[model samples]
Target: MVSRTTEARTPPPPSLWHHRAFRLFWAADSVSQFGTYIGNTILPLVAATTLAATPFEMGLLSAAETAGYLLIGLPAGVWVSRVRQRRLMRHANTVRALLLCTVPVAWWYGLLTAPQMIVVALLCSVCAVLFDVAYQSHLPVLVGRDQLLEGNARLQSSQSLAQITGPGAGGTLVQLAGPAYPVLGTALGYLTAALLLRRIRDPDPPAPADSPRVPLLTEIREGLRYTARTRTLRAITACTATANFFNGVLSAVQVLFLTSTLALTDAAVGAVLGVLGMGGLVGAVCAHRVVRRLGQARAVWLVPLATFPSLLLVPLAGRGVLLAPALAGLFITGFGTVVYNVAQVSYRQVICPEAMLARVNATVRFLGFGALTLGALLGGGLGELVGIRPTLWIAAAGTSLAALWVVGSPLRGMRDFGCRAGGADRPWS
Candidate 1:
């Protein structure tokens, strides 16, 4: 028999981004994200300008776009577990490309009705959810466990870059060629993504034939159970869900508030959004160092503290000269959001078991996206009743309370995932 020392040898060198498979996947995702940013701007413009949709109709359109996250999130998680994740992603990407292509065709035929747009949006949303879940699950397989944070940071940075450039280009394209033309860009992006994904050799270990297969409900419950039982994850989820809720409210009212109340032009609104992306770029670049210096627990609390005060700028925007302060506030809010997101996502990816990743991610997304839907509904109704400014004030107040969920919980003092095993033995169990 081999000696104990010999049996305890080091593992192989980790794969680098230069690895051909990883390069292909990264390139695909980078281009796909840029396209998504372009599509985001054009889609709403299509609904509002081309179709002449009302505020309620626009809210419904937004709601319909996110509805897939709530409806298919869990079921998609289950379905993904039974298939090869890479193959699933390829199919999903193909479907998304086809669906996006239809929009331009319908526009050419003058058959792009509001109802048809809603249907296309819903279908595209569902496909996106599938692609996202599969794509995230595929990461651990490609990059290995140790490089997860760095890999995620790279992806986030690329996405932020896309946000900064895509909107300006999309807006220009819309002005020149019409709203439908920009969607062709999105379709081509998806097609390129699919081709690149096809080149990624599956690096994941084969699934064990005898691995236990749990019921769908039981699998979901298991995921939730694990997350609820883990202190860091629980706090992060609560904080993120709450943030999404309040932000959703703000999103629903922001354009309306700008256009109707402050009487700002669409061009001005686009400029502000682009500035917000600049702030996000700063946050994303600095997130890793910030987490290392501040520690993860402190970083979690810092997010809201940095962000919530900015909401005051919203009401202040109605005052003539204060509009600059409001824009600054929005920038700060975007910065804090990016910082919080990087930490939270990295932490979750590190702590969770490999097998449960898809389910846990889906469950968290379901809660967060559901909150977004509710917030949009509430914001629309409340804005109609109390007026936009007061509605924004309420959103600010609600957002401030989100930090409370973390303060009293186990997340308050925890420093890292290294302490998790000991903390898992607490009374919260």
Candidate 2:
């Protein structure tokens, strides 16, 4: 493990806002996040309200959108390793914008079929996976190692704030302008993001010709091997994958629990989910401070373990104003999730070697979020066989178990794992 020594005498780096390249990167990502949210909000509306899509069709649309992660995740990482990241991101954004534009155009001509929508969603998700992987991998390059925590926190905070506003704004736009038209705004958002992204002039290192030309499969295997060999990375990956698996299960049923069991009005349900986004924003705002105080390693294990128990309250949510307990539960869960993500992601970025960062991130994404896809299928199947509420109870138990993966690992006792993810100076303080 590599450990970084802090020169306490050295002052902190300049603010990211003052860094023109970072500012553009931030703006581009902010715009793209909002656009993605708008697409998420409005496309479902188009499917349900305009096309009168069946449940199966809707499910297919979602699957098509997410399939890219399952299909191209590792390859995208390999691609990132072999090319200029910003260039990849720029093209990804432009392609997504064009793909989104096609949806409205097809709809306008009355030619948008369920299959067409599915295809567009699949292609757009492909771009999304590529762009997202490149975006994370590019950050450490742009900001340098020492500033990773602040950079990630700021970026995450931006995403959380976008999550808070984007869906509602998109919904409102759809109501005002029709679902097909609202998607035009999403296209525009991505286009704007592409333009902003193009303005960044980071001195990105070109892929070295002298580097061994490893086979793609070999590259993928090496990333997996490296992550598995790193004790903390492996543990963190297990914890995150566990959480994602259950979260996927919860996500598949959260709406049903809110609507059918709790009998919440649509507006009430929106408000509750909104609270989760708000909590995420709060958590992002506080992450760096919490990490500084708790030390990054302790923050990772403790944050999730501390707050995840609240998930049980979700399955017990009551109807109407009696929903406070569930709301509180979700809020705490959201807060802990954001805090955990900020710390662990920063740790991964700082610890992984630059040559391996994209591949490592890709491998991690595959392991971590791949569970989400499986859990979605599991949740759906279980919901069909058992019922919604029972399925939720099972999922809650699963989420509760995620912390066990980390608690037994190196993170459980670390106090100050300095540079290189080396051992902390003392046990958990």
Candidate 3:
């Protein structure tokens, strides 16, 4: 058996930015995030503009990106658990970089198709899931459990900044070139990230043995069982799942609400939507402080409740200046979500055993992200059945009630889980 000390060969850093391994990860992550944001925006734009896809095709594109989360979430955890996290991350980025490069090449040949974009989205989302689970697991190795909150907060801020900057950059690229052209930037970003990741020199755990021929389903079940039985994991997963469901409902309708309901020009709508990114930046900035002031455990539940009511503004949203109400609600939601995510995610990282960290993250992503997929379908279906405004009201109502999932759990009453809070009980079965 590998000794514990050998597994964690590098000591935790005092400050992430100054630490060599952490800095490389951070730079790589920032570039990847910017690229992801660009793809997130530009992908749909390409479908609408270059492909001139109908509503059905556009919705299919949306589903393609999230499809991997529902399809490969569990198996990904199992796979990541058996591999070295850093190596997996590097390999995944490399594959994604190569895959994205194909998009522009196809476009350059005047052969890019909607179906091709869908395939690209599907493959990219799968690689993203693989990298993400490993990426979260690797952070605790580099930064230590105590610093997880700070680490996540800094990372969130960078991501929020990317969200703010990426759309504008992608739009600029599309305007200067064409919609398919922005994909080249995403390819370059992934390549840069792979190079940055290669610079890290942390001690890698040994590779998984081919002789250990365990059934894949049995391995996947291990993570599912652990998540199903852990109280905190189950609660947080449920809360996120429910929240994403309602958020999905809004996502399907929000675009129509802005253009049709609010009558805002596309330019004005983009400006208003930028408020959402600013809100996320503010939340990322305030996440650690909010946790400090509210106590980590209580902050998780409190922030959600505080922000839940604000979502009603979306239903009440009107035309022109009246859009302020919905924008304010988005700002509040952004702030509350970042604060809650930082506290809860740090808690998850600290309390999980090092060996199971990747599994736990993957399991949580499976449940929480699966909710988003179902929610989008629900939103589109419901919007068609009733009206968009009624759908918005229903979605907001559902969101207001999602906080109940965490409130009844152990997470509500505690201050912190501590470094070793449930260390002995890492596996539930």
* Cα-based lDDT for every prediction: 0.73, 0.79, 0.77
Error of 3 at 154 (Å): 1.0
TM for candidate 3 is 0.88
TM-score of each: 0.89, 0.89, 0.88
Q: lDDT of model 2 at residue 370?
A: 72
Q: Give lDDT tens digits, candidate 3, residues 325-363.
A: 888987787778778888888878977777667788988
Tens digit of lDDT per residue, candidate 2, span 1-429? 999997678788988878889999999999998887667656655665567665445545655556677888888789998998888888998899888888878877879877888788888988988898999999998988888888999988888777667756765676667657778888888889888887877776668889989999999988888888888888899999998888777765565566567765444444566677677899999999998999888998989899888888877877766688887887888789899999999988978889999998998887776777667667756766788889889988899889988888877667645743335322131
Kindly report which residue stretches of model 1 are placed more than 4 angstroms away from their true locations once superposed.
1-19, 202-207, 262-267, 318-322, 420-427
Report clash pairs, candidate 2: 2-420, 3-419, 3-420, 4-419
Which residue segments of model 2 deviate by more than 4 Å? 1-8, 45-60, 109-115, 256-270, 419-429
For each candidate in turn, give its C-alpha RMSD to the true structure in angstroms: 4.6, 4.9, 6.2
True-structure lDDT of candidate 2 = 0.79
Give stretches of model 3 more than 4 Å off.
1-13, 49-55, 106-110, 207-214, 259-270, 419-429
Q: Best candidate per lDDT, number?
A: 2
Pairwise lDDT winner, candidates 1 and 3: 3
